[model samples]
Target: MFFVYKILIINILYYWHNDCFTCIGNINLYHMRTIKLLFTTLTLAVLATACYTEVIIEDEYIDEPVLNVHALLKSHELWYVDINATSGNREVPFLQRAFTVSFVGETVFANNNIVGIGKTGNGFGLDVGYFNTANGRLQINHDVDGYWSLEVFMVDNNTIELYDSNSRTSYYLEGYQRNNFDYDMVFYDNIEYLLQEYDVWEKVTTSKEGLLNDFDSENYLQFYIEGNRSMFNSSVDPSGMHLDDVLWDYSGEYSVFGVYNDETLKTLTLDYDFMGNDYFELYVINDSTIELYHSSSGTVYKFKGKGFISYLKSGISQLDKKRTKTEYGTMKVVRKRKI
Candidate 1:
């Protein structure tokens, strides 16, 4: 259009100049200059309009469909709270401890325990509170934690950000369904809680080839969290005895060390107050069983998890709660010893 206008203006000036010279015989220099100036101004105006119209067309934007925050909250069966990805100086205690949270109607559910994590509430855990969504915000009325209001920001189709204004913190959550979620990762990541899930681990099998040791007499084991310490109890009581009826022979602190590069393997050290520390390589046979290889004795003992203890009704133990607040990567790592 600019090119067309320039061509048209040139033709008009050519014809006008010819006509003025022919009709006036000798046109004044001032009149000729004035006519040229008027034509130049008109051409510039047309070019400016063309440029302005192009910019308007380029700047035009297509409207995106606004996300329905309420619907999104209920879309996924579970929202795994990515604690490590959280931002801000202050932490929200409930969110910090929760492995996963879910929204169903007006109720909010959270999987705070790693034990039976994939199976509890069909992977949604327990109903901790009630929640309402409005104006892209989530207001939660927790049964134990009280009330909280957070601005909901959708990060993606499967991710969301819950930003707390009062704390100036943002928590990132990833959405997943029960069937597709990686429950094994959760178990390995929080294996400490898994050990505490059972009332007792009864010795079911023992390899005969290993050398005799003090652990050979032990038939039952229990791991528990008290205050800020990870503690354990061992008993020589019969395997079929009830948890409360069994006599615990030794009680002491314990620590689980992660393998350097292996996620499936771990080392456990039971600090026996009288006999000294006993070290074993630990392996999970299934959700309800674990195998411990005593490095010193060369014995492989398999323990079956008995009497499941869910943390849902009574709330999580202090040690488990403290572990949740800390970074998982900071766990102690030990190099696997070659047999």
Candidate 2:
């Protein structure tokens, strides 16, 4: 059947092309135009179905960045500077290193252009950082916590111009997220009946940390307070270093109480005492960690304790601005727990 149809179509084309119905000179102008139109239509139909194309579209999503500045000044180490740029250019390797990191004291961030130093002695621009120094040669030793402001000047090799100073950045060397909890605990309340349901918290490991991210303990320090009785334990030494202590105590004497700031922000105020009464602003990090922020003396204590199913609900992972992260000393609470 298919071969019969093919033969019929071929005969029809042959008859039309050979002018079996219309001769070349005798054919009407309209008739010739009509045949040409049909031929064009057939050619178009075959061409349309003969080719295929696959169009590919590429797309990407970029999140808006949160710009911040960080500078950690250690006692006998180089000061590491990080200027965080969310959307703009981050680190340019072609720029030269910082020529000077002057001691602008505590008010340098606000002082604006207090000190100035450009590139030195025809040196090529590459990488720039701050070392713990005072007069360009003498090493400066200082115990700086919380946020300290500084000024930086970089000569861009691309444009041969000074880097933009308008990128107002803050130096928050403090590692732990500040005030990481939403719920408060009361040690001397009628909730003492609930206290019996909870176990006493103790230190988990015997190691000190230079940074909150450096906290690597098989057991994290734990603390609990019900009524006027509070107990705490840690394995941190006086030098703020982690160690294996067979004499570490899990429970100590202390009572704590706390309150929620408001329903809007839900800030927790936990007040407790061991040898002396002290309070902390709580910030929650996750199910296993929280930070204790002391605003007065600029101190931060990061504690990781699991099993607080009731209190560990909301997890705010971002670092707080008020918390001191560059704690050169050991965990303050554990160091105080040395009694």
Candidate 3:
């Protein structure tokens, strides 16, 4: 049936072309113009048949394995630096603040400008940031728990100072000192003693959960204690005398409690009134005790240790409050670490 149709169409074209050509010689102006139009149409049809396009469609959504790229500070280290067009010239690579990225394992992220050292699995990872760049010389010391923690500072082009957290000691290195390879590897006997003492503290606090439950109903004096010693505490006085006093209040996505005094990085406790309004107390304390050795009072107020759940809940509330304060407006733009 298809062949027969093709044959019929061909016969019609042949007759039409023949009629048009014969009429062109003896016809009037109108008839000659019609023949020309027919001839042009047939020529176009023949040309169209010879030129056809073959199209191939591909499925772009097919799943396949792919390797991802990350900003690598060192071979084993990766840090997150958010790139926005407005950062700078849009050409130079900016040393970004450090953050950890967990690709296969944990990676330390530090403010690339600061010398950083942290405890690695069995050894330590250290990087020095200088040279108009960051993490210029990435080095590691080998020893089981060899260099558990690090702090770095640049003394000069060839010299950098480092402090180890595990050892709690500092060392200086000349630019060309020991081929930059050999570490003076000092073993502090005192570190061993401190570790043993710390172990005793750990054993006593191992049953923290049971201790918290035991004080389920006890009235605290505005402190949270890990043992007889308070790890965190707050104030109860409304006159804003305590560190945990109503310095600020917030709620929403986060709740916040903050205390500021003349001292920088001073320690203080935040107390919460679990019975009254959801307000918290802020009080100053010594190392691990809610007791404040005030020059005026010269007496220690036995602060109470609230339960872990309430303390954490109050902390969360404080986070929300902080967020609100940030939204309102920031008085100072102090840089801090975040994860």
Candidate 4:
């Protein structure tokens, strides 16, 4: 009986020890799982904050004003004749008149001659100056009485600045257009004086735009003269007067040319009768050649420049025998004088 009781007691004690060990293992595992979950949550929060991105930007703006521009004209000589009042259906002197004139505005005639924009009560008056601005380009003003005037500015060797009677603005201009002048903007009057004064620009080659004329700063001299065909309305083919020959003087105030015509087989012919169409056309071509077109006999003609006598010889040699005059000796000299 005593042995049986001792065996039962030992068995009970062994079972209790096994249960205590099992409880300790369960508590350790739970603590380890809780620590792992907390670590994962902290890692996810950090990653979410780091994944976000940022962006930035800016803006732009500009401001400017409107302007009005015009090209003006001035002339010292004018000629007028009466064609309808001639006697015997032949041209007779009705009136030989001459006067000083200055004109402006647009020139749309086949001749490109235009009215002056600066026409005053007595003559042409042009007011050229500049206005100040808070910023940007300076304002150019042409305050003529008859018309609103604007002057276009250009850049050249000289840095253009704006100047009027009282003040020179911070801006400067190199060139502008006046009735498209013979060379358009290629030759601007305002910078002519400056270009002529600068040794660096002096003797520079000319282009379609203009050359640096060392003589007159206000003139962009073309190489050609202006004239009209004298035979366009004559008893001859009328169209036979289509010959053009006149060397122009861009530096001069006016260009005067005597009317002369010839055929290779004939002698030199001079035009005595006067008509309105008799005139000279001066203009620049390809910026290099100064071409002259004469109007006479109701026809228009073109001529090579006076500076190139060799060009004339080449041109004359290429003409047909009928238009070549051998007996007239040397062709009469044509001079382009300043007005």
Give the CA lDDT, 0 to 100, for residue 124 in model 2. Answer: 15
lDDT of 3 by residue, 136-222 (tens): 332332111122333455544543444444444444433221123222111111111111111011001111122222122222232
lDDT per model, in order? 0.81, 0.30, 0.28, 0.26
Q: Choose the strongest candidate by lDDT.
A: 1
- Candidate 2, which segments miss by more than 4 Å at Cα? 1-220, 224-228, 238-246, 249-256, 260-274, 306-339
Candidate 3 Cα outliers beyond 4 Å, as residue runs: 1-26, 54-258, 261-292, 298-339
lDDT of candidate 4 over 1-339, digit per residue (tens):
434544665675568558777675566777758756865675676667767888656565566554312211112112111112212321101010001112233211111011121232222222222333323332323222122222223233222222222222122222222333232322221111111121111112222332332221211222121232212112211121222422222222222322244121111132223422223333333222333333222222222222322111234311211110112133353423222
TM-score of 2: 0.22
**Candidate 1 vs. true structure, TM-score:** 0.69
Candidate 4, residue 23: lDDT: 70
Candidate 1: list runs displaced more than 4 Å: 1-67, 86-93, 167-169, 315-323, 326-339
By lDDT, is 2 or 4 better?
2
**Against the true structure, what is each candidate's TM-score?**
0.69, 0.22, 0.26, 0.21
Give the root-mean-square deviation of each candidate in angstroms. Answer: 8.5, 20.7, 18.8, 23.6
Q: Which scores higher on TM-score, 1 or 4?
A: 1
Clashing pairs in 1: none
Report the Cα lDDT for candidate 3. 0.28
Evaluated against the true structure, the overall lDDT of model 2 is 0.30
Candidate with the larger TM-score of 1 and 3: 1
Q: Which scores greater on lDDT, model 1 or model 3?
A: 1
Q: What does candidate 2's lDDT look like per residue over 1-339, in tens digits?
A: 444544765687788768764566687899879877876776666666655577988788788653212232211111212221112233221111121122223221110000111121111112222233232222322222222223322222111112323343233121111132111221112122222222222233322432333222313344444344445443333333333332343334433233433221112232223334344444444324445554444445665443332211113211111111121111223222111
| Top candidate when judged by TM-score against the true structure | 1
Error of 3 at 52 (Å): 2.6
